[model samples]
Target chain A: MQALVIVAHGSHLNPDSSAPTHAHADTIRSTGAFDEVKTGFWKEEPSLREVLRTVESEEVFVIPLFVSEGYFTEQVIPRELRLDGWDVSAWDSDGLSADTATLVAEDTGQTVHYCGPVGTHEAMTDVLVRRAETVTGDPEVGDGFGLAVVGHGTERNENSAKAIEYHAERVRAMDRFEEVQALYMDEEPEVDDVTEYFESEDVVVVPLFIADGFHTQEDIPEDMGLTDDYRTGYDVPSEVDGHRIWYAGAVGTEGLMADVILERAADAGADIESAIATVREATRKTEADGEPGKTDTDREPRETDTDGETQAAGD
Target chain B: MTDVQATAVDVRDEQVDALLKRLGSNDGPIEFDGLSAATDADGYALSTPESGDHRGLSEAEFRAAATEDGVAPYVTNWHYWEETVGHRGRHRRAFLRRAEAADERSVPARYVDLDSGMETEWGEVVVTATLGENGDRRYEIRHADDVGAAEDELDGYDDPLDARQIATDDDRGRYRPLKSAPTLISGWIFENLGGRDAVETLDVLYPASVANWNLEREDELDVTHWRETAERQTGIYDIIEDLPREAVEWVAEACCVDSQCLKRREWQYDEGDDLAADNGAGAFPCREPCSLVVAAARKWTKLEEEETHTYEFELTPSEKEQVEAIVDAVADGRIDEIREADVYEGANRYRTRFLRAKRFDEDGSLSGTPTDPTDEN
Candidate 1:
């Protein structure tokens, strides 16, 4: 059996933090790729601590829907998920990837193959670039527009800006945009001074954030001179400092994020085929046993072919 | 490909077997919220008592049936969490589960009394349970004010997370520091949610309310009293520890009462020393001093540091009573409830404005008496 558990930083105060997570879950659920798909949150219900108890599947793929590898992805999530054999103290400078992040629990026998965060995924670079073009309504935004990728960076963890830097470097290499620079919220080249670094008059700032919470909604807009009042969903191309500043929503809220999440799961060797097959076999067996065919209401994981009879005689 | 290391555990089959064992030994039928499990001569029979409809299946068929409608897993998993997991707040879970299942009314029971929807109130929100296919339950959550309001009339939301926005503010869009305040806005409904999802939605709506309420029911609510909580403060808030025993009762009366907050005041002056202030009669208990209360107390503590000087303000007996009435009205959060045209009411907006206009000198003061006579305005 297989399951995909997307762990996100949900907020009790700001529901928008968890909105993208729910949207992505719903989108992925419609695809019918895995036997089960569930979301665990840091600040919401079915928390990271007890989310594992709800999953009946043995082979689970846990993905962090974060911007990049940092304190939460490295320490808090691993500790909360109770990745039994993982050495969370070792902060790998190279950052998390599909190959280097798997952890196996010796007690529950549940193999949790940890996947890299969605933001650091190779596909995110394209999503960021597309956001700049889409928000400006110009397909050739790279020709004259100065694109600034904003990341919520802190001096505490340098790795928080790694994903934004990675995307910036990749987009810059494409030579499509006239200027592509990475800006941080807390660190130097701050989002507050976004227009000063760019040579172009029309600048497009896209927040490389997972959700449109405090940073994306209020802070970025205020810092970028889009609005004096703290608010969300600003009208693009607002004149700020004698320049047209086109702001886009957080990159994680993009609908294409469902593809990136699935890609991360597949890259981590989620074995979705086996999970899909297990459900198909369960449905076939139930139908052959003269039980009603599978329905949309049937979401629970079924017993494997070998366990049905053995289960009745176990105790 | 990622490396694989795992041992298989068939949890679903085991859950089915546990239910089977319970079914086999039962005198009649083991009844849960809506469905009933009974053992027959051939194998096992699961039925809805309200509908008088039953279905028989073999042990293997039962295992297969577990995944069909999720009822088998739902019952077994609930039992698993209750028994083997040593789950905390058993009473809370049971109470919430029964409430989610629509209490005594089943799906068919709702069909019989169609207009009389199976509804229950959690804080200010009204939850209505509706029947789905094959004994499945779907819940609708709305503000209690808009209980029977038309569906289209309200902004419908399917995501439970949207409750945060609804509960974040009052009708005037003012941020509600206290979540359970009676000022919840109407005209919104969470269309349909499953049992677990409904409970989860409520958890988002009223953060940790169910868990805390559960802890209270289990006699495991660890309450941190005012003195103990105040003593642990650091920085500027450290002055709160110096507040007198009599003043602590003022803090309780000001912040912890039902008028100020929805949570019942569980904390007292100390464990053995109870305050004279009336404990709030809210359904849920406040286990500790909230941050708002602590912040207010900090400000009050600073104000208490100032030397007291009784300044004389000559006024009639009715005017004195009116001044007392204004303080009482503001403390009880009833300033808005008093009408503007109701001049007879001492705390009425027009009456208060008239009092301010009549009593003050060029500077805003009562009967030309300065608070601090050392400085002239």
Candidate 2:
């Protein structure tokens, strides 16, 4: 049996920060493509380390739901999920390439498959365009609207801006709208300066983000002068500086990502039939022999210090 | 790399002129409006600082004229010392401070009410004039007895209590301390203060003050400093320019963005890259994990700049279970219970299993980091 885990950057302040991640996980679970599909977050419940232990399957697929190959993807996610391309517990596992699809667990024979982030997938470009079109009404119209793909670009790294720029290019190439602009909250070609990239008065700004948190909800709208209300709460087709600005929600939250998740799972070469059989056998065994999902190894650490972050044995 | 310079200007010409004239001569209180000169120290008598002729009034005479008008809590006008340097309505300023102390216990009722009138919101009651935490008169209220106050109010019942017209601390309004005319940065010169480029960079970074101020130029004009002068005077934000660019880069570049996502914002503003780079923890503004570097550290162990060696060993199903127990034990801080833990061949591999189990890649390598500002963390 195998399980799928979707990882996201969750917020401690906004409760809705990880909602889409959880929603997508639930949507995948309903299809039963894998024995289990769990969601883990950095700042919220079910941390990556904790989620890894919940898998009863012999394999697990870890998919990052981020929009780019920046810090979290290059450094944080790999570090958190222990996907640094080496498994010292397994001989010769040290030099495996970072893009390697599979690795056998040294102790449990559990194979872990790492997949690319959902944002980097080729399918995401279309998702971004679709998100924009929702606000613009239709792309087939003769009077097309301008589109701006806004990202939380930074001065510390260039790849952050590049992700949005890449998508903006893809969206631009579609030529469905009069203009396509890639804007950032921090870096150059700022969201506030989106007017420079487009000639049309009716513009659509789609947030190229994984979640509807601060950058998507508060900062961009404020900078772009779309509306005073945060996170698309107010009416769209709102006029700003004589231009009708139509704002769309973050690209990652679209329901279409369910297909992308499955595609990533398939990219990992998960054998659904075998996993299904294994899950059935395990269930039968649990009922027949009373060998529930309990194991001494599943026990949480016993902490000497009561105040330590040591977790409970089971959630 | 050039040093970060300071652009702050010190004493302004108008302020200096005002300071000097007040200290240079006494502006006597006199009767005005075509009134005959009265022997009594009369209230409401209009007077102006008649330059040079003010030299006739003695300090004692000025005080007598001002005191006869009155001292705080009951005073109508405090223009006597208002013209003095830095100290305006000194008695009333002290009075407001005492009234705000919750523990002080002995304040006039009107002053106690005035304190509440300063901050936050209250119902239906109209607030004309209110003080501030600092000594800023925040509003220009028409405090005529029959001005804005309502029928049952203190005086001049018109729009609520028409408080007195005065100064303000409103940033968008005139008279904001930082937005004063001529931009009040100090001008105390410091030789070799990081030179031209440094000061220019400081000018860009510091939100206050401009650059190239010279004391010699001021002294060349035959102006003399009775007290210690400043190297450069500046608004409160001037100090930020003095910090190393990297230390304050996040502040300037920050978008108030919330995410744990890291992006490339490679800034070349490090004109002083010759200095030691900041490999230490940067700012973490996100309450939840932002895409920023610091927030990524919350859960992403790969982002953690640490060293770890990998060890792999095959374990039987039961042996794997034992490793899990040991890992769990160690994680729960129950290591003592695992004293005999290595009974399994994978016992030595427990810590390694912990990382693998925790989701690290095969190599204990956290080296996939793509871009950085200083090439340090």
Interface RMSD after interface superposition, each candidate: 15.6, 25.1
lDDT of 2 by residue, A1-315 (tens): 778988886653444556678667766776677876766665553444334543446678878787655445554555555554543332222211123256654323357786766765656776676555444445342155788888776564455566677777877787777888888877778888776677899888888777665566666767777656553345566677778777776777665566566666766676554433333232221123322322111111111221111011010
DockQ scores for all the models shown? 0.03, 0.01
Which residues of candidate 2, in runs, are more than 4 Å off? A84-100, A104-109, A136-143, A228-233, A271-315, B1-377
Best by DockQ: 1
For model 1, the chain A TM-score is: 0.80
Alpha-carbon RMSD of each model: 14.7, 31.7
Cα lDDT tens digits, model 1, B1-377, are: 11111111123555666667767664566665555677777676665432344467787766565544324424543343334432233433454455545345443334333233467777778888654432344678898889778999999998776776777667876656566566778899887776556766776665556656666776876677998878865444568898878778898887777666677888899999998998867766677776557667877887787887878888879888899999989877788899878889999888788788889887888888887887656
Residue B84's C-alpha lDDT in candidate 2? 21
Deviation in Å, model 1, residue B208 alpha carbon: 4.6
